[model samples]
Target chain A: MTLRRRFVLVHILPIVLIGLVLFAPKARPGLRPCGALLAAAGVIELLFLAALARRKRAVEPATAPCDTVTLVWALLTGWELATSVLHLAHPVLVPAPENVFDTFREQPLVLLRNIASSLELLAIGFSIGLALAVLLGLFAGWIPRLRAFAYPIANVMAPIPAVVISPYLVSLMPSFRSASALVIVLGVFWPTFLGTINRVTSIEPQILDSARMLQPDNRTMIFSILLPYVLPGVISGLKVSMTTSLLMLNFAELMGATSGMGYYVQNSITYANYAHAVAGIIVIGVVVTVLNALITKFQKFAIRWH
Target chain B: MNRIECAHVTYSYEAHSRRETVLHDLSFTAADGEFLCIVGQSGCGKTTLLRLLAGLAFPNGGAVRVGGAPVTGPGTDRAIVFQNYTLFPWMSARKNVMFGIAQARKGLSKAETAALADEYLEKVDMLRAADKYPYQLSGGMRQRVALARSLAMDTGILLLDEPFGALDARIRGELQRLLETLCTGEKQKKTVIFVTHDIHEAVFLADRVLYMADGRIVRELPVDLPRPRADLCCADADRLCAARRELLGWFDRTETEVQV
Candidate 1:
């Protein structure tokens, strides 16, 4: 069979099987909601596959998404069979896919509030940290004495995990939110600062020669020439720094915070609400993926010159 | 009066705790509007000499003077076109040219700089690719943009370190002719220090050619050929041929000396 046919067979078949299993005579009652959710997911998958197939003639089929869909379908089928169909797993620990998906419909406002809280903290911490890192990095990289003084200190500090000190920071700071933001900033700042320093120092000699010929003042040289020269490197490094900051933020939230995605999951697990905890975990995954996608788009736009 | 003077300039590079001198008390002077070519084999310090004149680097001894002023650092009065990476990769061709113009003619309005940039790009026949970035351009086209940039600057002194050296034969000849036209046209001719290893190019474009080897200028040859010499078919073809032959002879002698 052709790749497209094979993708349909592997991807679409599992999704159909999942629907069948969901609608089949359940080992217990109250499965109609689960059946409805599975049917809706199957319809969405069908539409997506149709779109992919239509574009296949113009572009090669990306195997990753096809494989991802197949894996997701298989996991859902297995989870439904194990929890609701066969009753093979622990009753409270392993929740059915329906219960997890129900949380989206049942407690959407609460989930949204938690996401907003997490995003707000992330935005503030990430923006402040990245801005400070880039500005300070440019200055520290340009000046010899400052670079010499800070390079070694950053080297020493960059490797210390922000999570290790969050407890102390939380106790020291007046608010848990400030401690979380501080943790994220420290996590992102060192690497970005060091990367900027190295990038500025290693700018191509020919470019430096051309800029120097212009006889720009110190401020113009730093802002106009050096900043643009190091921008591509900075943007490429942003994804890593962002991921680190997110990790630090979540870890801090898990330690002590009244609101956040991490706190939501921690709160669910405290009451042994595995369904809510699993839903919260999935929410975190979706949020991180969406943020990463945005970062990728920004990178493409920023380095369009390349 | 001389526009640029390199007086007994010497320079060296330090590598692995050792100093290797590149220019040994080299001295030369170019009168205003003269097109001077420094021709030498590879590793003969032709580029080093050009850099000294450009004020991109300082000599360990003596000084490079432009218009009776000692060279300190790179200035707007002298514009240089290096062999590679002369244009900023992040900027379009038009922006690169405008950058130089803005530096040289400060206080000009944006529209004025843009117009001047277009004019020079037109002169070099690179107007169509004005919005293209450096990476989008071919090697020859990038060199054309670099040439347009220096030309647009309208600096009195143009230091070219084998600007066309990386191009193929056809493109190199075309650029050489373009450069010759621009340098000798109605506009005030810039004092150009054109460095090349090709003898034919030197004889074709330069008013005076300096042959250097082993950190010293071996000979100086002045070409009296008329402008627009009509390529190798013109009346001055024999003189051009003789100059090329003499330059080749110097190269052969240097090779024999090295073998011995």
Candidate 2:
């Protein structure tokens, strides 16, 4: 199809979705209105289309983004039809899109505050975990005596899943918040520690040879040569480490804590407010996507080498 | 006194439960301020000898010495360039050179280190690409940066193990001339040991060329050509041509023997 035609397809599909949500007659009794959800979806799609239009001249192969948006809109229309118009599904189990998204229009501050709290914990835990791993890994990797001592210990500890033992830790620790943070730390530390050691040991032979020829002192070798050499590997592994830590954090929060995204979801489930729980799940997805994008941008700036 | 020495040096590699000797009783020396190139076929232990000189590897059976002292380990007295990965991939060209200068001359201010780095980069015509990381550069450009780094160090001994082995012919020739000027132009000449398989390159760069075969230096040829001899200018010279032919003859004979 022609370029204009493809864009028209993207522009037209969302309108069908909006029309269904705004005007579809409800067969289900006492279903919530679609105003908040429709408004939110409209604004987001508008921003995305604006970006697409602005970059039209240099738009990517013209299939992936446009088709994806069309597909999303088509799915939204199907969901609206199935829930509010036909009422074919179980009314309580499968909530109307209107009620789920209304949770956003109603109590955004509670969600935001919970997100902020979770992020703070993640940051504290992740930073401490990564810093300790890299520092200890460097010393251990460079000195054979330390390597011998630390390797066995790391091997044993690195295998245990923080999530599996997190419930016990939650009860054992004085506070739930501390237990949650500890879970994130334990989740991030081991893989990064082992990864750092592997990177140091497996540095390119020629690069190692050149560094040796320079005759770096012990401190310089660790901080200067070995650190930068392993930094790219560490940064590249950040996504996996971050994802793992976030899993541990949410799992711990789901089990015990009171105010994180995971808690928001679990509490909503306890109160039979599945709509709010679904909204909380959506928030968690958005946060993870944004964090991953930020990490990718940071990786580009940090690692200038191959 | 000899600037570098290797006496009865032997190196072995144990792999897959087999002990393989790489260099067997190798012995050679480069005189102070002389450029010595060891030309050999692959697997001839030429690079192992260079590493021994650089103190990157210890001789299993014999001693390797530099400046009349038995080499203990890597020291600030030597700088080296390898076939690949001489510059750290994470560092820019200027930083790599600066890092080398820092390791060799400890007390230089950061500004002084940077200035020295730029000077060496300029010598290799890589000043424009000083900020580029090694991955951004072509193989030849990377080699120029590597050369700049080792030269910037200004150590007493310089070791190069097939430093230009991966470059195209034209770039290789340009670097060859650049290397010649950099080594000889300095008032305090560094004792250079360049290992290569290229006979013409050895003839072009070295004051003396050592030919190695199967882990031993079998012949030494002295090039009597004039200093800073133009490329192809010394090609027609009788002595250089004879040395080139003799080196070529050795490699050809070895290839035939291996095939047989």
Candidate 3:
């Protein structure tokens, strides 16, 4: 078969098999929701396939996305068969895909509220942590005495996981939100600070010479020459830093928070609402993926010279 | 006057509890508007001497003086183009040139500095790639931008440390001609101190050439070749050829000394 024919076969076989299972005679009453959910999913996949075929010329043939789409279809088909048709596993522990997906339609407002709360905390904590790190890192890196004093301290403190101190921070701070933000700041600050110091110290000697020949003052030297020289390294490290900070924030939220994506998941598991918990996990994945994409875009725009 | 005087300057690099002297009591002077080249084998301290002249480093003993003033540190009075990585990779060609102009001629508006950058970049035939970053450009193009930046600074003293040394032969010749024209073509010629290992380059571009070896000046030869000395078809071809041959002999003698 041609490559295009193979793509169509791979995509269509899974959809047809899934459709047969969805419209088959009902083996149990709760299976109705699963069938409805699978039917809707099949329609969505058809739409997606149409779109993909339209844009297929833009993408290289036989790349990751093609295989990825096929894999996703296979996963969904297997999941539907196990939960609805065979009833092979523990029912409550592995909730049917329909019920898991239906949590979105059933509790849209609740999910949105939790997501908004989580993102708000992430924005505040990330901004404060990154700004302080860059500012202090630049100063500590540039000055000899400051670097000598802080470098050893950062080496000692940065290795200690921020999550380890969250319980104490919660008790010490006036509010849980403040405690969470503090945890994230501490998590992000040390690594970024250390990286900045190393980068500033290791700037290419000839570049330093070129900047020095311009006869700039201390302020100009730190802000203009040193900052830009070290920016590509800093921006490259941002994705990792962002991921760690989010992890820290979520861990803090799990301790005793009233609302957040992490709190939502923890709360659901407490009440044995597996469907809602699964939905929450998927939401977190989507949020992180979107955030990573945004960071990649910002990196490209900021360091076009690189 | 734009004369530069190095009064018995001494320099050394201290690495891991050991001091290795690079320039030992070196002394030289270049009159105003002189195009001087310092040529020697690698590690013979030609670059160290240029760095001292550019005020990028300090002498352990004595001083480097420009126009009767002792050099303390790098100043806007002198602009240097290093062999490689001199252009800030973070900035575009135009921005790099503007940076130099802004430093040397303070109080100019943004428009004025930008215009000055354009003029110099145009002179070096790099105006078409003004917005290109150093990494995006070829080695020869980057050196052209570096030359543009130094010239745009409009300083009395220009210090070049093998500015064209990393380029291919054709591009090196092209830049050599550009440097010669820029140094001698202007009415108020700038004093230039160029350092290179290429003897032919020294003979072609220098009004006077200093041959350095083992941290000392081995010889100084004055080239009385005619203007626009791009080729050997001139009436002074024999003189130019004789000067080149004499420099080559010094290199051969140094190689024999090392072998012995």
Candidate 4:
């Protein structure tokens, strides 16, 4: 289906389900199943959907984030009405979406501090890892003997998952932040290094032939030709590395004495505050989205040829 | 002091699956300002001969001497134009010509180099597309740019290996006429070694035609044609027809089912 059609369908399906549950003739007080609040919810849901459909054509098909975002918002609103306003859900265990929002407001300082800590580690670790990967990858790819020696080692090490060794890594390092950053670095380094090698190897033959005819030395081959050829590929590989780096960072934060988004969620679940835990999950989603968007913009500016 | 002497040169290559011998005891000399065309069947070392002349490769035995000095490699003294892939795609036509100028005369400023490139592009009737890349140009236009680049170098010897072989017949005729005009217009003319399998093309253009078979020159037909030579309406047309017939007969004797 076209992106526009799919976008409309995503918003429409939830509205139809909510309408069926709350807009029937007997959805009123006493004699009705719930009250006028449930009927009012159906009207609010329909208005939210109409507003969404108005903006659907402006949305690009491949960017389905709006659809996902709208669905998440609508599902939470429905959950709120079912549990708190209508009293239709189980009493003690099921809290409304209002409780989730209240949980967010109650510990805003704690949440902000943890987010800052995680972001600090993420920025430092990813920068070091990506910079080292590019420099070493370019070196290994350009020279034959270096490539032959480094490629087999990278092949063996790249396939091992970075998350599996988090517990042991956490014990070995002096501080939790150091261990977490190291895990993220290891997580992001290998694929980018390997990708750079493949990209350098498959560069266009005509460009290489022209450089060879010019009889450029080894320094020129690496600086002038190989770097430009691999820049586009490296920028593209950043999107993948960004996600994998976050995965390692969060996993490492989950284990030990730490102040991070992962630790916040882990600590909240420990105290049986599921509402705070859910809010933490939402914060992580927002943080990752913003980080990826920044990388994407950087990539666009770096590569104009493609 | 004004000649390229190939003193009994020989070269061979190893195919991936077998050994192939291309040239054996090949000896020829091209004098100053002489246009020589080497015509032969495919795989008869015609291009290998031009490469040797251009100093792109070395002979397995014997040497190539330019002005009584042995050639080492591709120097500014000689410029080469292949059948195709001569221009770098990333560079525009003017830039390609300017690169030759920079290689030939390094001390010139960028503006001086650009002016020289523009002058040659105008001479070859390619100034309109001087800023266009190779991929953006037609095959004939790219060849014209290649010609302008080679000519702008103003090398002592111009080595063209089937320069117009990839062009269509109509464009080929136009470039041949352009080559003639360029060759005769200069006061101190340049020597040209053109390699082709077309008999009429050789007879129409060259001062001397060297026909080869089995990796050796078998016949030398001196055209002695006049200058300002147009492709049509010339006495050289009749001479070209006669030389074409003679070369075809030689070709048939060597291999009866011959097709280029």
- Best by TM-score, which number? 2
lDDT of 1 at A124: 88
Q: Deviation in angstroms for A154 in model 2? A: 2.7
Candidate 1: where is the Cα deviation over 4 Å?
A11-16, A28-32, A39-59
| Candidate 3: tens digits of C-alpha lDDT, residues A170-244 | 889999999988988888888888888898888888998988898988898888888987788888898998888
Tens-digit lDDT track for model 1 on A1-306? 577686667766565566556466567444426644565476658855775666656566556556676777777778778877887888788887778878887888999999999899888888888888888889898889999999999889878988799889999999999999888888778888888888888888888887888787889788878888888888888888787777778788887799999899999999998989998998898898888889999998988788
The candidate with the higher TM-score, 2 or 4, is: 2
- What's the CA RMSD for each of the models? 2.2, 2.0, 2.3, 6.8
Give the DockQ (2 decimals) of all models.
0.77, 0.84, 0.84, 0.19
lDDT of 2 by residue, A79-144 (tens): 888988888878877788889899998899999999998999999999999999998898888888
TM-score of chain B of 4: 0.93
Q: Regarding TM-score, does 1 or 4 come out ahead?
A: 1
The candidate that wins on DockQ is 3
Once all C-alphas are superposed, what RMSD does model 3 give against the true structure? 2.3
What ranking of all candidate models by DockQ puts the best one first? 3, 2, 1, 4
Which pairs of residues have clashing backbones in candidate 2?
none
lDDT of 4 at A229: 70
Chain A superposition TM-score per model: 0.92, 0.94, 0.91, 0.78
Tens digits of per-residue lDDT for model 2, B168-225: 9999998998888888765958798999999989998989999999998888998877
Fnat for every candidate: 0.70, 0.94, 0.84, 0.02
Clashing pairs in 3: none
Interface RMSD of each: 0.9, 1.0, 0.8, 4.0
